[model samples]
Target: MNIEVSTLAHSMLADLHNNNNNYGKAIPGHIPRVPPNIRNINRAAYDPKVLSIGPYHHGKPGLQAMEDHKKRYLREFLTYMPGELEKLEKLNSLIYSVRTLEEKLLSLYNQPLNIERDDFIKMIVLDGCFILRLLIKIRVRLESEADAIFEVVPLLRRDLLLLENQLPFFILEKLYELIPKPNSIQPFPTLKEMAFAYLTMKLSTDPIALNNLEAYHLLHFYDLILLPKPRDHLIFESNQNAPSTVPQASKQEEPGIKITAKKADNFLEVPFVEGKLQISCLEIKDVAIPIFRNLIAFEQCCPTAGNHLTDTRFMDLMV
Candidate 1:
């Protein structure tokens, strides 16, 4: 560095330059100064790595060094790999497994999976894990693009299935959540079961719902009856059959047929063999005769409306 000052700089040289020990060399324009907030870009060009790595160590590292670094990173991340080849082998295997499973699933389903049944649960869980892994791989690639494998992760079907509990409710709920509300269908066996689950958990304020309950029309095995004895049949259906002979059910009969009770246990039941009622059939339905007889036999004595089964303790009562 030149110490002798130009005529232009001679005046600006300070007395401090007279340190006295060295030559009377007034510092040239080289005196160190505090860097301004913004730095000079031109100065970075002289950096050794600027040609390749852009002045950063990693930037200057040649292709070989980059490959070596990648190998080391893979080895360390693979954890079980002994060297670069082993790491590459592990990566290949992992990538292949994900791709193979994804391909098979998409192929079999002909579309994305809506994992509702127990059969689909396992596959959905595996898919979720695979997506998470893909997200991690994307991060490692540093190529921050969205088209990579993770496109499946946030998809509604897998996400919902993943949220399900051991019961696979997560699987069903997710499906419902994703489906447009107006067109959503119950993916589970029965809405009653779903309602029961919600009721059990105290999830919703609405209470028990029943079939043909006037207020709510739920699908159920509707009670059917066949006219039994001629006398009983004449009493109920016969009179009603003839437009005239059928005395309009007196207002009195209306209350019984049209239940106005608050609780279900109070619904009118026509007495049969035992106290068991057949939804008000005058005669034991020929078809349902055995059912009525069986009920009578099972209940021991006459099974009346009073002998009805009512227990909140009942759970999973499929019938």
Candidate 2:
């Protein structure tokens, strides 16, 4: 028994060394599930309640209702494909394209999925097509035309924003590339614009500032718009002498302190100036905490995602 155990250990160590030599330099593909201890704080925020977007929660019991809706959306989407091929032909072509990308897509996640290869490809196609349709609907203000499930656009939007309920951005982009553009002379909105429209549906401010489109997923893009880039020059040299307590609005009306809003390149970047109190154009709704919590989880799991740690820590200080 001892000799058999020793042989197995030696074989496992050899395999580990071989794998490391082949893939040690590769970047992690998928953000990990939230650590158990941290997830205990608010597990619901990390899990999807309405619909599943990717392989993570693909065939869960409660989310089965949306499966038919996703098929309907995919069918509608294929009708808009550039060629005149039959729907089955187009569908088969799409599945083949995604299948070709199977290995590459698998490399994007941190953990290996236990689903079958065909099931994984189907999930990617269905989720990617569903997202494209939703984005197009938002672009044209077609919520009124939505079916029963999407009548509550807010709920669908919330489901899409959940961390585990996400497909990589590239999958959506590839599917988008397959669709034919509108024949109208007017320019069509990009996927990012449509996403920003859905995310900031309740806000009155313009959503045109998200120019950098290099995001891993929708949640990452939302984080890019929500957090401000650091500005070292804005910090005062003599901060030790500054007052910690903020004055009330009525008290600041006197001549001693001046109140003004800073002009910033983007809404998130707005900061207070030196003369008096500065009110930034921040929009914090009830959904803010859970959204940030899941985004922080993503950053923690994937180090390749930029320094969200520093940004989250700074927000903690403000609190």
Candidate 3:
């Protein structure tokens, strides 16, 4: 009995030691799921409709239709390399380089994925390449007029901008660097330029120049576009002493208050000067609902992401 007890104690000690060693250094997860309190309110807004860009919603039944498109884009992207041999070599190199980022990549998500290591890496590569290719095609107008994907470009745009459907910008940047630029006498636009162009394709006003912006993901990139410019900082500061609450639209019907829509580069700008309130003109459509919800959800989920959506009194105007 004494020997058996001693052996049992020794086994427990060994197990504890193994568990301690297994606990690798903890890294912060940049990608977080919307909390139940917020997600329960409007689940559809936070969910991807057509395509899933990252692991969180990668294999959903509804999003599966786009999986074939992703593969097709990957194949098209590979063809950017001149010869078959060069394509094979570049792909192999990409895989090897991505493998080295396994731990770092895993750390970016809020939870441990149930996917196997190989499967996770494959998903990353496929999704990253698909995004880069899509952006490239959109920038160069290389997509066929009858392309099914292009037919639903608006839906694709919504899905790509969802808070949950995001691949890290670093992964996309890496894939863009690996893929050879198309052979053209004119210089190809940088990846940042391509992304900006794609995002602002339908905007009437020109977007602010993204000179030194660094985005964590596509949603973050979009959020950055709505941020007030440096000059607007002074304007915001001056309004710090303004009323704590904005008058409701119905209440603003009182005389001497005039509200007007002004043409501006960004829709988030709302400036009140000399009894007049000026808001940037925004054409709201059915698609704008989910996009706004997702942007607000992102702001709520990530505290570090400033309240660009909510703080500007833009939501009041939209409502």
Q: Please provide TM-scores, in order, for all candidate models, with all chains considered together.
A: 0.17, 0.75, 0.81
Each prediction's whole-model lDDT (CA) = 0.28, 0.69, 0.76
lDDT of 3 by residue, 32-70 (tens): 676678789888888888888778887889888889988
Better of 1 and 2 by lDDT: 2
lDDT of 2 by residue, 88-205 (tens): 7778877888988888787765455679988899999988888888777666754456467656576677677766777788777777777544555257777777777778663324
Error of 3 at 317 (Å): 9.4
Best by lDDT: 3
Tell me the lDDT of model 3 at 173: 80
Q: Each model's number of backbone clashes?
A: 12, 5, 0
- Is 2 or 3 the stronger prediction by lDDT? 3
Task: Show pairs that collide, candidate 3.
Answer: none
RMSD over all Cα atoms, model 1: 33.3
Off by over 4 Å in 2: 1-5, 11-29, 81-84, 142-146, 180-186, 202-211, 229-232, 235-270, 275-284, 307-319
Instruction: Give the C-alpha lDDT of model 3.
Output: 0.76
lDDT of 1 at 208: 36
Residue-wise lDDT of candidate 1 within 1-319, one digit each (tens)? 3556564366456443443322222221111111222114232212222111101122234322333333333333455456778756755554444344443333322122233333343334333232222323432333355532234322311211110111122222332222212112333223333333322222322323431122110000111111121354425564355432222334335545431223222123333333222343234343333233322221222122122222212212311
In model 1, which range of ten residues has the least summed lDDT? 215-224
RMSD to truth, every model: 33.3, 5.9, 5.6
